[model samples]
Target chain A: MFSELLGIAIIFGATVLLAIPLGLYLATVYRGDKSWSDFLAPLERLLFRAGGIDARRGMSWQQHLMALLTINLVWFLFAMLILCTQGVLPLNPDANPSMSPDLAFNTAISFLVNCNLQHYSGESGLSYLSQVVVIMFLQFVSAATGMAACVVVFNALKEGTNEKLGNFYDYFVKSLTRVLLPIALLVALVLVFQGTPMTFAGKQPLITLQGDTTAVSRGPVAAMVAIKELGTNGGGFFGANSAHPLENPTYLTNMVENFALVLIPIAMVFALGFYLKRRRLSYMVFGVMTAGFLLLLAPTVYYEMQGNPAIAQMGTDMQLGAMEGKEIRLGAAASAYWGITNTIISCGSVNSMHDSHMPISGMSEMLGMMTNAFYGGVGVGFLNFFVFVIIAVFISGLMVGRTPELLGKKIEAREMKIAIIVALLHPLMILGGTAMAAHLYVSNPTEYAGWLANPGYHGFSEMLYEYTSAAANNGSGFEGLGDNTPFWNISTGVVLLLSRFLPVIGPVAIAGLLARKKYTPESAGTLRVDTATFGLMVFFVIWIIAALAFFPALALGPLAEHFSLY
Target chain B: MKNNFASAFRLTLALLVLCCGVYPALVWGAALLAPGQGQGVQVSHKGRLVGFENVGQKFDWPEYFNSRPSAVGYAADGSGGSNKGPSNPEYLAEVNTHVAAFRQQNPSVKPGQVPVEMVTASGSGLDPHLSPAGAYAQVERVARLRGLPAERVRALVDARVQQPIFVLLGPSKVNVLQLNLALDSLSGR
Candidate 1:
């Protein structure tokens, strides 16, 4: 327990230690690079004149986000092209060819949107040409696009005229060349140390198996996993995914991979809170997310630690954690840890199966998915969390007869409506999807229910949770449900599309509105969002929203699983 | 708050550049100057350095201890499944394939038993290191077929297993590729 406590403290300490430096750097970049601007001035003017847009004026937040969305849309089309024609491309080892449209769209929207929810394994489905030209390259720039959005918004929020949100292209390029590419390379090297396969070779030596010598598949996976995780993109290079020894070579490597998955998402809030000069504000976001994150983590760890008693009946002696749907070396601690971290960060990679977790553990993972999407990542989570804070603060402000303000800007009617919609989207998706799954389709029953593994209500709950995870861009699965089927694929795809765009619109709207507002300097009576008080307030708001929407769904699934197993 | 917030964000962005860009350039340069490896980006073989042997796809020939339980990684380019469980219908079927294969390779061996790790794949399906027990279990069969003594084979295993930082962090294991290479020389294959 002391060690665990110490581990938690160390984790938090590292987060803050790294965040302070990182946050300060982000602050500087957002203030704009005058030297670079001067150098690019002529080109910017030329391009703007050619493109028939005003070069001198700053883009409104709406206009800026629109540009981002438009680029993303185009990127989606480009990614789809690679996926569709992958089979015909050279460097095709498998002779495997062209992706199905649905799969192609899911993957394209995934990477282009930076969600990277993969339905296809890389080594087989994609040719080397497809892998390099499409996935790897998209990874570099798509990552930049997301980071640039936040940087632009951060600048707009701070800049005096409420005019210059900064140039989109410059920020995107810098984010790619300066941030994503370099970090990805370093991480890739570290991953190689952790035993990720780094090769363009045909395959490793063949071991004779089943009277046949099977040639193994090999490609540039180490490089990809490095960027995929760092960029918070969750697509796996192969089907066995991260648990593959090559993907995660050792337990130490596993820990590092998990660390890679989350380091940025947690760090970003400090980036936001600190750069805003409300150290307390960043602290508050930090505290709230930590509280929310840890709440989710504890139960997952406990349930995973509790493990499967049925396995215990065999006298095999499984550990006490949520052993179901998890790796033995990793155990429940690590699985639960990944579950919580992935959902919080809005990164969808899974090291363990979630569908098999004990009921309580499952809910906690769900709650992590629900994370009000707080400063969530490059695009979605943070904006969602900010909106939640807006409404929570706004509601409280109204009740107390004080104006609701977040980060020195008034949280007015439009912002509250947007937050409400964004906050409400998942519950609607979860409930609607669950209801449809239960009322309409019945999956071939899987055999492992202590409760969650069984049929009927628990089964319905599983469907709901799966949709919730998918919709949330939180890819941790219940594993009890077979979702590779068309119903799930289609439904998840639909939910994914809606979920992807909805939260985005809300944030862009909020940024636009906020961009239009003149600065309201802090006064003594104004609500302070930086202190522990604000932390608790934000924490309360997050809890209330999660409880209201998810409690029943969680109860039917993980809650029931817990009692039946116990 | 305004001023402070901007400063923190700037600091973060700068550090990101430093960590992501500058640090990597330094590492890449170091690799170039270093005595061995990864300088050209591929982990290659001794002679042609034709391709990187370091990662991906296990070559499952009879003599070598297979590296990982790959999904679609081998020649098929389509992922596969062992599909065995404590009670799977295909469980016995898959195990029999492993059992039969091992038995064929070691005609002197008994028929029914095989080590579990040789059959089961890790979650990632791309694991390169064999578990210690998995490697040790293969020693008797490998030694007998290659006409090498058990002690020598054990020595090879010991040589392949990576070293530890402390008692706990890393596990000792045989590198499947290196072990197989040594086995080939001994067998004159």
Candidate 2:
């Protein structure tokens, strides 16, 4: 028990340690006034001109909104072109084929929009060119888009009737050069040290036992694995995910991978408060988010350690702990920890299968998906955090009997309305999507799983999990759902599109409104977002949104399955 | 201006060197240092090496412990599963066939108590080891087929146990290929 707690703490601490300087750097970079290291300034300008993007085009809230949509659309097409045409590209000794159109558009838009919907495996499907251009390229762009949204909001907080949000060209460069690139390179090196494979060689051909020849999958996996975690994008190079011996070979490597997953999302909290010249506010947000994140973590360790009552009922030796879908080396600590981390930040990389996870353990993971997943999309976590901040601002204003003023802007009907939509966006997508998937697909309840195979509720939970995973962009499946079919493909794709954009527009509009208001002087009655009291409210509000949104539905899915097993 | 230009040139040159020279070479250095890591876990047949297996695979065949269920065909590039609901007739059929095959080959084992891994494929479908139970279940058959004592076969299983490379990485596991080759050495198969 102690060891598991220590393991969870190590992962959380390592992530927060990174948040400090990186957060400070992000804040200053987005502010765009300071000269970035004497050497990096001109190079930044050069990149803007090369992309055909205007360096001088500072945006209004309206323009910023359009730019996000336009940029995502353009990137979707770019990613699609690369995926469909990857067949003829280099690094194909066996001439690996191209993706079909439906998958191509789905994947391309998914990555560009930061959903990272990985329908194909990275080690085999992608050639060197597609890996670099389509997949890796989108990682950087998707990460930058999140940073770009935060900068717009940062400027909105500082706005005094100014049309300019911040510099988009500059945000792109700063995110790419300063934050995302350096961190990705660092984590990749660490993973290499911890034993993730990094090779450009073809699959090492070897004869199988029966004398049939087969080729092993190999590629530039280490580089992509690094960005996948740093950007909070958790697609695996191979289908075994981090469980593959090559992808995650050691205990240290497992720890490193888990750290890489949450590092950025946690750091963005500090980045928020620090960049806004409100360090306390970032800590406060971190504190609230951490409280909710930890609640999920606690039960995860407890239920898995309590051992599966089913294993006891069957009277089989389970000294190996929750042996279903978990590795002996990773043990319950990894299953519990990865579940907590994925839910906490929304990175969805799994060391063990979650569908086979104990019921309460699975519920905590689902709650994490519903509540924060902020480590939402890469820069998306911070964008989501800011939405919570606006809500905090409105509620505090009402408590003090004053107009809710955040970063000098009045929280009027427009901003509050947008915040409400952003807050509700997840519920509508997650709960509604789960209900629809449950009702439509999943008809054959009996003989669902040969082991967990029984008639009724357990199977229904599996159906609910499939849709929740899709709508939340969580990506980890129940392994029990037949999701590769066109029915799942189209529905999941549509849910992914709406969940991603609708929630995003709310923050964009709020940031725009905030940008127009001037900063006001703080008085005794004025609310300070950085205080401990306000922090508690933000935590409760986040919980309220999650509970109101998900608990009843959760009762239908993982929660019920958890009880039935016992 | 000239001095400023010289320093800027040097800085860019260093950045270029860092991106091109240091990064790629460092990664290469790390790869070579840990040749036994990740997909690098190869099964050697004397002087010749055969293949790699993830620690997650099952090994039930007396000649070899099978890898875990990897529904994704062994194409490392095409990582995925049958995505079949466990309730689906197809999945059940596959599981039952695995059970039938195991029962036919190893007659000594009690029915309905076959280790779970023997019956199901791993999610990746390319695992390379079996559970100790899985390896032990096959011990009797491999020994009888080779005309060796069952204790000796079990001893080989005990010997090949590679207490996980790191305890925190996964469950304590033994490599399937290593155990099989060692079994061959013992029985001179």
Interface RMSD of each: 9.3, 7.4
TM-score of each: 0.77, 0.84
Error of 1 at A389 (Å): 1.1
Clashes (N, CA, C under 3 Å) per candidate = 77, 34
Candidate 1 has what TM-score? 0.77
lDDT of 1 by residue, A1-566 (tens): 22323333444466557656766656555555343324534543443343344433567666666666666655566678778987876767667779888777766766665665555666566776666656765666566676777666566556354755766655665565445665677677777655455545555444332233454555666667777777777666665456554555555656666666666666667668666665666776777777777777777676666555544333222322333333434434655666677767766677765544556766776777766464365545666676677777887787778888765777787877887988888788878887777656544233322213435445655676677776777555554465555566677778877887777767766876776687788798787766787667767777788666777777776666566656
Model 2 lDDT tens row, A1-566: 45555666676787788768767777766666574553676766665444445656677877776666666665676668778888987766546689887777667766665655566666656676677556666666677777777677766765355778765656756776777767778777777666566776777777654354666776666777777777766766676577665676655677788887777777677777776677777777777777777778888887766655544333333444554555544656766888778766656777776665677877787777777534565667767777877887788778778888875667889888888887887788766766665655455334323323323555666666655666666666665555555655677788778877776677878877676677677777677777889888877777788665677877776666665555
Report the lDDT tens digits of candidate 1 across residue range B1-189: 343234323433343344334543444444444322332223333342322233334656545655544433444233323221222224335444655665565454443234334544444443445645556667777776567888888778877776432344323445566677666666565
Q: What is the TM-score of chain A alone in each candidate?
A: 0.88, 0.91
The residue-by-residue lDDT of candidate 2 on B1-189, one tens digit each, is 343234323333333343334544556566666555433556666666566644333243445545555665455545444443323344456656666777777787776456655554444455555667767777778878778888988988898766643333344556666776676678665
Model 2: residues >4 Å from true position, as ranges?
A1-5, A31-43, A52-58, A94-96, A121-128, A158-162, A193-195, A209-213, A442-455, B1-41, B53-58, B63-123, B127-171
- Candidate 1 chain A has its poorest 10 consecutive residues by lDDT at A315-324
Docking quality of model 1: it rates as incorrect
User: Which whole-number lDDT from 0 to 100 does residue A373 have in model 1?
Assistant: 61
